[model samples]
Target: MRAPEREYDSDPASHAHSQTRTLSSSPPPKTNGYVANGHGSPINGSSKHLKSPVARVELPGSTIYDDSYIDREEYIRLVIQSLRDIGYIESAATLEAESGYVMETSRVAEFRRCILDGTWSEAEGALGHLGVGEDDGLWEAKFLISQQKYLEYLEMGKITMALHVLRNELAPLHMDPELLHPLSSLIMCTDSADLRQKAGWDGAHGSSRRRLLVNLQSYIPSSLMIPPRRFVTLLDQARLHQISHCIYHNAPVTPQHFSLYADHTCDTDLFPRITTTILQVHTDEVWSLEWSHNGKFLASASKDKSVIVWSVGPNSNPDIYVHLHLQDHQFPVGCLAWSLDDTILLSSCEQLIKMWNTESGALIRTIEAHTEPVSALAWVPDGSGFISASQDRKINLWGSDGKQRDSWGITATRIIDLAVTPDYTRLVAIGESAKDPILPPPRSDATAASGANRNGNNNTATSSPRTLEYLMIVYDLTTKQPELSVSLGGQLTSVKISSDSQYALVNHAPDEIHLWDLFTGRLARKYTGQRQGRHIIRSCFGGVDGNFVVSGSEDGNVYVWHRDRAILLDVLTGHGSGSVNSVAWNPRNTQMFASCSDDCTIRLWEPSAGDRDGDSSTRLAHRTADDRSHEGEPNVKGKGRSRESWVEDDSASRSL
Candidate 1:
């Protein structure tokens, strides 16, 4: 069998950095205290993770509620009636768990209302957590311990901590209506199997499985940011020729929403398609996408707990989404990484991480890996252990068995992103911290901020400090500890490291990209002026060729950039909304790029030899021979030529 290709390119130390300088003749950017923002600012602040501990509610013992203390059986009658009013019965059974799944004051009220309105069944694992009525003689007061732990995190802001909360310390216990309050353990169930399973046996998903606790739409308020208008405007101008580049040249949009160009000509197209076949995730915003080795399949984890594994082929259509429903994680699937031999997919959410069989999608193992939300996941290039960054302000390395091989955390705020080295020797993580106005620190000055730049959607708006500075973290996986830390001097959003793992690309508040060196922890190269394209949305570089990068913006245009020269390659205009979400390269071919956006389509692009612009080499030659020809004129970048088309899911709307 053929060995698999690593996600990382060959090491940068081994390769020559001077190679980038060669392909692009333009001068590298001048260093400045301020990172440039492309367009304007937005209102949403970067989410901060804060862990909140579970507040223990003291309950009275049996003696405190005795009839001798009460007036009569009347008090008992009243207590039973109140429970019934909240959908709790005089008999055993009926509790539902959610973000506020506990049988509490407000939750009970909500449960009562939901039951009356017929909206109660939608509650996750309600029937199991509520327990069943078996003969009404004996009751099992079991509780989905993980769900309660999640609630504790929600209350404590563990999700806010950016670290995942682990469920290992506490044993896996199924939900039972009787198991309402902690420290009040009761053998409430008469079921032989439920008791037997609880007494003896290892806890795993398939047999005695319980649902994972997850908090979707969970939010915390922070400061928003903006980019600059000049850059956005410049990118807007470059967008006009983008569709032409994609159609004829088949260039992918860099994160800057530009086509990869050296001087004025398009670079060798990279990131092409192995097949045109597409797979539908159970939901939108497929937060994570990874291709398994052998290139025969793709594993995608969604905000929907379901992980869909799709068979790869151009015209081959089999199971589009193999819905692997693991009762392990109840939260939206945030990050996924497969083991080297392609056995397990380590998926993380709020406080827990699980290992699943790639082929079956079943939860084979579970690990309560972090104290907060697991923000980022990275597989070691060597396929040994993997690294994860969490809101808990830490980075952790773990083995496939869910064991913590090593762990590290910063006193700094939340760790939002993580990147691992090729040999799995180093890891890079990025996160934001509050800018304490009084304490002066490392960055040159406040003017160093790139937050003023927006994506053209915002006219002119400045946001508040609920948003503060973000940090770029570097971890030495070999040392098993943090290597270096740098402040972006602004709130960071997304971070991308080069394939060579030498340079780190950062996207901050507003619209700006920082190309920083991994060794010195200093900004080396910076590119400004790519924003929401004419019709596209998001754009950035680090394409397949390891030369130039591409980006698709909300403006509905794709831009290719080589050093300072920003060029519009080709534009495919069919997205009704004039907005895009993400653009990516074909891992196999550098030439073909793909992008998906709010427009509900995935468009592919490549340069064509015969670009219908009528300014062909032959046309130019013919024009040069005639005195009346326009040979001396600069080839106008665009003449309305396009070869772009979209591959869409016909069943998307219908399936909905």
Candidate 2:
């Protein structure tokens, strides 16, 4: 049975009186599971004309189409409700009178009167008639009625009567001690005022009985009492079902935007595909990129040994310019992270982590704590400190001032990447463990024959192959203790947590991205089709509700997939030759995303504009080998190849 909706009786006295008057005109006669007729006349088993209520009633010249599947009675009830919803009381009453279908039965109307009129014994006896079976709901409803009666008895200064009801009536119901103890304690009140204050309920003359009636309605069946706003609920549910099935739905659904005439669906052109701007500030390969928390700026770490911060233009403008160029890193900048407030940015390279003031572009502090290259940085949700993972098998906590607050001991595996959940409850990390025995790399048959001949002539020592086992460990942020560990057998490059912190997207090498449900410690889905064997390609959760997965490929293209279906939606090609290394979706604008590449540029993408007559692919500037040879120049010095040359090379791949 469908559970009824929740709605309270607003004007209890008037509503009960109105229902009483309507049903009293022609009281329905009791029959054996048979529906009453238009004149409130019950049909017996011998009557062949009238069947059960579930059977369709034949109506002459009905407005509804005969071929339609809608039930005649249900349609009339919905019409009545729709009329009432728009404050048409007279119209609704007339429709009910003409349709000969009361919203509730005659028995239910009597029960409503008994509940509102403070007739406790009569109301309690009517519960079974209202279809409340002899179950927990029936007893629970009876307890509420008896409790209200006890409170009213005390309000009338009848202390002895309240005690008798508590001991004899409520105690025999076998309810929980927690509920019975409260009623027992209420007996100690000094007077009516004290009783009312302690019980937290008004007297019987107040709205207490009306509230009781509303609660008891849930115990009865919807056939006896219709749920409030049932028609509106059904329509809203149907609209949501349509939206859920739409693969490209990224925007919120509203009555102003959606129509009831057709099924809901969003156009694919709304996805971020067109490249509106190209940022060519970095002369070397851009390795990592991240948008600021407020989405006003974008930060990129590059192989040029520099970290550049770019300011995003306003919504009306479609341009990005270099905001700050920090050229202090000795090695290639590997990763970047932003504070929760977007005031601080951290860039990692080799064994050093640098904190910079985002607005002033001044270097705040530099800390060298890890022996190996710092692999990832994640800020604490509160902005008090940050956590950094390194390839040296260690995880360190540092304050915003670059002070080491705490450090976990060396782990068994080398930590590669880590992220702090948005809720600040858990910290997850991807570590590589080499506990298994090493096996040599497979050699070709001819190479093995040549090696054997060389070994027979002169014995030469060969190097053993390296082995690795990836493990994802989850730690309680408060206790800083490992809570759950899952073994994912793959070469993991990076990890990104969802906004709700319930799932994590882990980039797996050799062509797969695994979506893991963190709570279940299981891989929920695998997204494929992007080339990711050697280079460290990054992916992120995008779209308005994070229903899309956007990733970069070593094949110099950006891949977008539906997160729930694992369907490859688009392969965006813009970078000239080098691999697209990282992708970042704007936190503020759902229609925009950014992708950086080894082509030494950052491309900003937005939904396709209809007025733009060109193809979906963005035009890229042609570049000679000499033009890209320089490692650390802030800007390109020479004229690259023509736009036509790069367009012929970067072929756009649509949904597969």
* Per-model TM against the reference: 0.44, 0.68
Question: What does candidate 2's lDDT look like per residue over 291-349, in tens digits?
Answer: 99888888988888888887674330222345677888777788799998998999987
lDDT, candidate 1, 159-245, per-residue tens: 532123223322333334343333123133234344345434222322222111111101100000111232344445666455434
What is the lDDT for 230 in model 2?
Answer: 70
Lowest-sum lDDT 10-residue window in model 1: 216-225
Candidate 2, residue 369: the lDDT equals 92
